[model samples]
Target: MDIATKQPGVLKPKVGSRSQNIMASRVVLTVLMFALGILMILPFLWMISASLKLQIDVFEFPIRWIPENPQWQNYERVWAGRYPFYRFYVNSIIVTVGATSLVLLTASLGGYAFGKLDFPFKETLFLSYLAMMMIPPQVLLIPRFIMFNWMGWLDTLTVLIIPNAVSAFGTFLLRGFYEQIPKDLSEAAIIDGAGHVRIWSRIIMPLTRPAMLALMIISAMWRWNDYLQPLVFLRRVTNYTIPLGLDFFVQENTAQMNLIMAAAVTATIPLLLLFLITQKYFIRGIVLTGIKG
Candidate 1:
């Protein structure tokens, strides 16, 4: 009848052995995860390696992980603009900053309107927004290009920023966050003579810093990585974005893989830093948004 000796309804664990086994499993998993993280970073290692290599060493069969002579000048050469690399960096910054700014502002306002206002056709309007989201950017490319031409905006920053200024995804995301705010909060603000704009700026804006940061990371990454848009809109070498910059690197260099990799590594550094900085907020946003609406 004693609990220590009896098997009882459920068998008891051997406390010391079980604890050790769990600790051992955790240690193994920790090591495995560490190894996988290294594997993910391996290509970056090789990229840095190949960037420093000479053109011949790049294609060499037995690849050295590090160049015999670390070519620090490779970074300098990307800015040298023998191939418009610097130009492309400028172009990318302009488009990215512009597009991300527009996306954030427009999405925030649109999301607030949809979430807080009970205007006529509100449901229909949101559905229409959702419908537009379904229509892939590629499908709209031709019409958008023509529209830009009509407005004389092609190859201009306006052409790039205006099209992506409002994102349905952002609207949807922020609207969900907005809904989490009680109706009484906005009502009280209004009763205190706060206009919608005033409320948005003073009240809602301060609360949604994490959400905005999360949105910025998403939008910035997309714009930074987008190639097809830049390829289509920017025809001149001087107007190229980073993706286009890579193309010019190869074309101008005549298969100078070292320089190309060098330029690529240079370009990737910003995005990597971006990811590292906002990674915590980005993941937190994702997890928080999964809660029931």
Candidate 2:
């Protein structure tokens, strides 16, 4: 009887040890994540630092984390240069918006049709379209250039906007999201005399906002940083997008390291702002895609 009465508290030390182990593991994970975050952001810090330093100080021994003499004028010079940076910004904005809009419209419709609507050989057609994603864009570059040339679209904004109007990846992404929606909802809408157009517009589209937002962000980033297409298509200085304009700036001012960094920093601001604003939607889209798929 005495032994049994004394044994009630024996397990408490074991429970305390287990809790301590969990807390220790959490602390280790937190430290690792913090270190990784710092590592990832180091390049951005260096870029900003380089943008403020003089040309000669850029690669100085024992790399400078902070510039001794900050050159705020580097930004001014970049903006006020002979090559029009403002025009490049406007061109990027226009192309990014137009292409992103077209992608959203086409991808959503295509996804809806493939995921929900019945059609002849629908699976085959979607599979074929998905296969196109496997083909390298480089292989089609010459053919696309010739076709655009034939259409008299070279050296124009249309060249940038039209070719990227639709994306197979976008269609596939949205289709996966759409397929996760319950069939009962769509059937109920159909019984209520709603057409495919009405059902998609009213029910499907609103529910998949996260996927659409993700696509928008992705398309915008691709169009904004598009160096190769703009380089090949655009001929005139005034028609140059941000990437091409930056290349031209660098070519003209090879020794002006600070100026180049300043231009790069300016070019990066829009994408950073866009990501910061929509990161929630982007993360949600990715998570949902994984879960649904």
Candidate 3:
């Protein structure tokens, strides 16, 4: 009985020590993650602070997170400057919305077809489509520019919208999500005389809301912040999107750090708002994709 009691006492301390070690490791990980988060956000915090400080105060020796006298007029100057700032917002919204909508429609249809339907050369066609994603977008710039020039689409919003409308990444992402869905759902609908379009619209589409929302957010961010394509395809001042317009603003106001930061903040707000609003679905979609992948 003494030996048995001594064995329990030895094992209890070992188990307690193991639990304490795990708790210590967890605490350390939490601190490390918190530090990394602050490190990553420092640049953005500086941008916000600089936007509200005087030009001289922007890069002061001792950084001030909050200025004694915040320059509220910096934002006013950015918006009311000689350049048409609002026009950039309008152009960006138009291109982003148009491209994102088309991405959703095409991705959903393509994902459904690939995941649910089988036809001649189904695998071959998907592989070929997937191959396109391997090509660097810069490689297509010259050819796309030539084609757009020939078609008289240069310097027009159509050039922006049409090229970005179809997304290979979205199709791939949604296809992965769609494959995880039970095939029985589609089979059941088919037995009831439902067609592909009907089954996709009424059933599969609703179930993949997380994936679809994730695609929308990703597509919108891409189109909204695209710079090189807009720079190459667009020439007119009025046709300039936010990225191009911001470049022009920077060039004109190079010496004015406050106004430049203010412009950057203005351009960044929409994206921040979008992510904040859809963050839950966005994270869920990413997790599901990883799990299904």
Q: Which candidate has the highest TM-score of all?
A: 1
Please provide TM-scores, in order, for all candidate models, with all chains considered together: 0.88, 0.86, 0.86
lDDT for each residue of candidate 3 in 133-174, tens digit (9 for 90 to 100): 899999999999999999999999999998888877788888
Over the stretch 191-222, how does candidate 2's per-residue lDDT look in tens digits? 99999999999999999988888787677778
Pitting candidate 1 against candidate 2, the one with the higher TM-score is 1
Instruction: Assess each prediction's global lDDT (C-alpha) against the native.
Output: 0.79, 0.86, 0.87
Question: Which ranges in model 3 have alpha carbons more than 4 Å from their true place?
Answer: 1-29, 286-293
Pairs with backbone N, CA or C atoms under 3 Å apart (clashes), candidate 3? none
Candidate with top lDDT is 3
Residue 112, model 1: lDDT of 89
Give the lowest summed-lDDT range of ten residues in model 3: 1-10
Q: Per-residue alpha-carbon lDDT of model 1 for 1-293, expressed as tens digits? A: 12323333235467765555566667777798999999999889888898888778887777688678988787778778566466777888898899999999998998889888889999998999889878888998888788877888877766777788889989888887777788888899999999999988887877888777778767877897888887777666777788878876877776778888888788787778876897787677666544411
Predicted structure 3: lDDT:
0.87
Better of 1 and 2 by lDDT: 2
